[model samples]
Target: MAQTIVCINNAGMIMQFWIEWVNDDGTQGWTQANSGDYPVDQRRSLDMDALNSQGESIPPGRLVRPHVQAVAGASIAGDRYITYTPGSGTAIYDVTGTSFNYSVTLIQS
Candidate 1:
């Protein structure tokens, strides 16, 4: 089964988000759902399977991390590393940020 992470930008400003995971080979990996900044009320979905450096599906039971950051020309606002397991169901997260404040919420589904 494939796992997904959905990000809803609730912040008043534009933002960007991504997920990270340790590959089977012990290297760092990351993936972003959108090619550009997400505006308020925007939502995007990313597959956990393609989060690795090689863009391969993550093995079952592996741990994954989520991250959210601000867009260019904006104050440095970011948060990360909410641990998650693959094969569990879709993971929905809400991202909010302002000036220097940022937050991430894992919405139970």
Candidate 2:
């Protein structure tokens, strides 16, 4: 994991995350579902559609705090670490792809 600051200058906050592993499996599976909705997991995902100050693209690689998204009713924005924690029981990815993998992390309530 990357050494991260909880927030831009957060002294302390119960920050948690839920993660999703998106594989290029090209098939529908449990992993394809909204696993982030699982309350048990400290679920969090990046708001891929979020815009920047200049309305420019701000993906995870760009570190968009305001764009860091969580499930509905969650009160959180982006911070520093992009975590890797998916809901339990089931595997992270539903299908196995012959291609690379992408991770989606979100905030937890």
Candidate 3:
């Protein structure tokens, strides 16, 4: 069972997004899916297994946070902390906003 994070950007602007793992020791780390900024209407799929920190995978039943921001040098526009158990399935997050009032929607499947 593979876990994945799917981000759909409909914010009408270029946006940057990533997933951070909440380590057992309260440390935060990101994955390779944080490549760069994403254009409007773009959809990105990030495999949770891509997370690697000191040769460690995301522990089961851990918390994974998703972050999204405008690429135009602005602060984080939207974010959500989700408690995810590895091997569960796919988690889909939709980014939608207008005038910096951004919001993230978690679509359960």
Candidate 4:
């Protein structure tokens, strides 16, 4: 796996994403269903990499596949990364959006 940063730009919205926890146990959690609510321990941001298959970055006018999106609470904006001890199982993420414009960044952890 590799460290990466993804920048997404659309019509009027722009997003910068960094994947901090990419453990084997990371899975897609739930929305209203309790089956997918897992508490995270800490919040941290990782760097971006292009050669890394485990990492993703997006920019405007790009197309991307649907994956678990990291979102903040209503009062907050954009996605956030959380870190915690490895769990007995993988952490699940929600699958949303099919296409995106992605710009990527690579950095050392």
Q: Which candidate tops TM-score?
A: 3
Model 3: per-residue Cα lDDT over 1-109, one tens digit each? 2267777888777777677667888888665456367786888776665554434466656677667767764445225566656666777787787526677677653
Q: Rate the local accuracy (lDDT) of all candidates.
A: 0.61, 0.25, 0.65, 0.26
List TM-scores for all candidates, in order: 0.65, 0.20, 0.71, 0.21
Candidates 2 and 3, the one with greater TM-score = 3
By lDDT, who's the top model here?
A: 3
- Give the better candidate number (1 or 3) by lDDT: 3
- Whole-model alpha-carbon lDDT for candidate 2: 0.25
Question: How would you order the candidates by lDDT, starting with the best?
Answer: 3, 1, 4, 2
Quote the positional error of residue 89 for candidate 2 in Å: 24
lDDT-superior candidate, 3 or 4: 3
lDDT accuracy of residue 63 in candidate 4: 18
The residue-level lDDT of candidate 2 at 25 comes to: 53
lDDT of 1 by residue, 1-42 (tens): 237777788887787766666667888665535325778888
The residue-by-residue lDDT of candidate 4 on 10-104, one tens digit each, is 21222223233333455432112111222233222323222232334222122111122333321112243333222212122222232242222
RMSD, one per candidate, in order: 4.3, 16.4, 3.4, 14.6
